[model samples]
Target: MSDEIAVPPRQDNQQWLRWIQAQYGGPACIRRGKRLHDALAQLEQSLARFRQPGHDDDWLAMVRIRLGQLHALAGDWSKLEPLLDADSLRIVQQLYTDLQPQLRLPPAPDPRPDVLRTALQELQEAIAFFNRRWLRHLQSLDLSFYERLIADYNRYYLLEKECLLQSPRLARLGFQPLPSLTWQSLLGRFPLLPMPRLRNETSEH
Candidate 1:
């Protein structure tokens, strides 16, 4: 008798597409990381080559902000983890996961519109949760550290917001910008929280 051949189970187009995405997505993520690293290197070279007189500080500040953004794109959590305690770090980790696709360069041809829409909704939910809980989490921590971490989060958030706004695909997916954080807004939201301790207080104690 002739050997029997094993037939694979049939999958619908959407199922097959999802399978392909899952299989290829890992390498795609690596490629995206490489591209971002390259772009950051190029930006650094440009900054070095075109340092304008009298605008040195401005240029440096802009480049540092861009570097922070690139670090986020690369998922360099080390930059943040040291500044946060375990609970706050966990919140930031989730926020970064949601923000990643929005920050990175878009994949060509894009995912299906439905998939993109669902992702945007999920991202929005993550941001809302972070906004609601982050300040509360900060209240028990060292005030100076809280301010530093919040500042870093705000910078990364601004960069992510700008990327989403600039992407036509993201705009069509109904991405809405999160409100920018400021000292006044932060105080307003958590008015009763004790002021972050001053450096001298720690020194004196």
Candidate 2:
């Protein structure tokens, strides 16, 4: 009745997690759920918001990537411009502008050990809070795009991956159907926030 994942005794077993993820989707059938990307594309296209035709462009996908960059402090956001149309770019710009005030940090204070430790602890807490809220919001996002991708995988992933085997039945061998990806399944792969360096957390003891 619940979507929360249950772990086996050997939780580190990748094969077990993959199998569980596969079985945890919608009832096995071809094309069970609607495609999110196509539906969004149709709506945006009707509004004439897209400049490039015939491209698999999903503005929300781009939005998520850029947002992740902002959170992770990893990539160059300006470089994202050419990948989007003018209107879509405008949306991204406004979003960044709005979030800037909340995300901006006052310059780091004294870099002494005590201050640094406190800062690290506070930053980690903030990330944990953001992680929960971010994941919940993400789960609420349209599943159509990812669902369709998984459905395609459900349909053809094995054949493509195992084509070298050269036997259709062998290609299909030992295959189990994977459902659309769920936040829970993603959680299964990575249950902890990665960056405060989980391993070193115990080193302090």
Poorest 10 consecutive residues by lDDT, candidate 2: 25-34
TM-score of each: 0.20, 0.30
User: For model 2, how does the per-residue alpha-carbon lDDT over 3-113 read when each residue is reduced to its tens digit?
Assistant: 987654564546654555466642222223235345535644542322132335422333333333343341344443333345544544554453332323434234344
Question: Could you give candidate 1's per-residue lDDT for residues 115-162 as a string of tens digits?
Answer: 333433333343444444444543433335434444544345445434
Decoy 1 TM-score against native = 0.20
Error of 1 at 189 (Å): 9.2
Candidate 1, residue 90: lDDT: 59
Best by lDDT: 2
Instruction: Please list the C-alpha lDDT of all candidates, in the order they appear.
Output: 0.40, 0.46
Runs with alpha carbons beyond 4 Å of true place in candidate 1: 1-105, 141-185, 188-205
Clashing pairs in 2: 36-144
